[model samples]
Target: MVDLMEHAGANPGRGTYGMAMAASRTVFEARRDCAALLGVKDPRDLFFVSGCTEACNLMLKGLLQPGDRVVVSSMEHNAVTRPLHVLSGRGVRVDFVTADTAGLVDAEAFERAVAEAPTRAIVCQHASNVTGTIQPIGDLADIAHAAGALMLVDGAQGAGHLDVDVAALDVDAYACSGHKALLGPQGIGVLYLRSGLDAMQLVEGGTGASGADEPGQPLDRPERYEAGTPNTPGIAGLGAAARYQSAHGAGIRATERRLTVRLREALSAMDDVVLLGPAPHDESVPVVSFTSPRAEPDRIAFELDRRFGIAVRSGLHCAPWAHRTIGTLDTGALRIGIGHGTTDADIDALLAGLDEVLA
Candidate 1:
């Protein structure tokens, strides 16, 4: 990545044939790797963006117009919900399907929500960042298809941790963050659009192709979505990360799940701790959220970091609707995310810290 950046820096003429050809090859390779990570057969179906948030914005703002009704799960991150809010003000009707306290969306309720209106899209998370609950995406996608609505999945948490097959899930589009489960750099993200789906371009600038001369007409799939100078370095790093995951994702997920189970078991055993989201053995990512009756989530997080030298995310996790679904809207839960690098010793250390803090 550094080498690529340095090369680009040395040759600042991005429009030159040599630089343009190099960047184009790098971007295409990165897109192909990202598509492989998402179980997409065609590399052209994928495009790069700033992050999941930008991808969500592109999907919501670019795809749906005024008076279009969209259904979203209650456990959506701010990425999806916030955009929906903005679209609502612009005349798009957004309705939410309720999830249980375990953060699992009710299938019947979701079906009803889709059936209740002429929904244009059904936006749902593959997994909740706050609760680690794995949504029934295939079933939801079936529902969306039945209602004649596009199924857009937010795979921010699910991409690298779970098996994500765009064709098998039959979703119209899938958005994911590179930093989370993909173990990639922070700035890179990926969005997979089913072939032949026309979406309005979110950002427009020099595509370094013939379309740059003609303002309105853009190039094909990825080039249509990616505008301006490409993030070659970030994309290169992301591709490396994706390749690493492709080789070792199963082992990584197994390790994360083992650590998560241990952490959840310890938290659930504590008398003062109230575990939110799915049970420890249930289908979920390696994310765990819990709150203490004796301590505020913020204070617990602070003590864990300051005293135990352990870092964990706290508060609403930018999913207020998830908090509400889990019955923790007033007092948000502390989120403990077990990643690919998390170890059994780390879980033990976290448990020891919690014991001292909650005692």
Candidate 2:
């Protein structure tokens, strides 16, 4: 693993004053590479933010006007919901689309919601953080566009786990965190804004350009969205991480699919186990979750960690609506988010731990 973030921050774009000028170039390149991964045609549309939360907040607050309604799926992360809630406090209304028993959103329901008058945006998670259920973004985009709403997808979980094409998906705006599946350093993330769509500025400050003006921000493509100093060191690490993942995506997805399928099959066959998400779709990646009748999720996770040395996340996963769809909201479920580095032996070890605990 190349760990650039672990090192001290490098000052970029500095002058004789040792100012941090190189950092701007570092983030600029990182934004470009991330835009490529996101299937964006113009790299200038990519903006680097503090993380996915800031990106989501930027898109949500910038895109919607007062009294405009936004539609989001039940599976959105708190990053999406929390901002929307704040917007609601300011008189913006939010409507929720329904997810199926498998925790995937119903494309028809999404269409219906967007078709309603006053719906300005339709937001959804590309993949559920808790259930790992992949949303049908391409189809959902069709519905959103047909209903005259722009699609805003939270790619926090999908960006690193799967191939994301903002153009093909027809999403107007998308946000992704660098730290999760991308294996990049925290404090760096990318937001892709569709061409021709003007996102309202949430804040204004120094953009390292147009010093001749009265200190107002530039109206340029990315500079309009980016205000103040960029995260150069984190962005450098992010650029390297994108290159690394691009080269290894195929092999990593292959390994994840194999291990996840094997684990899902074994768990699905158990007496008390119930797996979530699509039924092993051929193209799906392995980020499996399950509920056990004999053991609560947190307890099972604790047993796996303390006694079996297996790490897993257990809770509502910040998507209560997703858990509610799968009837796991009250108690939550065990989420085993497998990464490129996970192995067959790891799955087998987890299974053995479950057996011992459930038995």
Against the true structure, whose lDDT is highest? 1
Candidate 2 to truth, TM: 0.92
Stretches of candidate 1 exceeding 4 Å from the true structure: 8-20
Candidate 2 residue-wise lDDT, 42-67, digit = tens = 99898888889889999998898789
**Backbone clash count for every predicted candidate, in the order shown:** 0, 6
Model 1 lDDT per residue over 1-359, tens place? 87677564322215556755666667778788888878888998898899999988888888899989998899999999988999999999998888888999977788988888799998999999999999999998999999989999899998998978899999999998988889888898999988998989888876666645685848597778987766677888899888899899999998888888877887888899999888878888988999988899999999999999999988889999889988998998899888977888888899999989988
Error of 2 at 9 (Å): 4.9
| lDDT of candidates 1 onward, in order | 0.86, 0.81
TM-score of 1: 0.96
Candidate No. with top TM-score:
1
lDDT of predicted model 2: 0.81
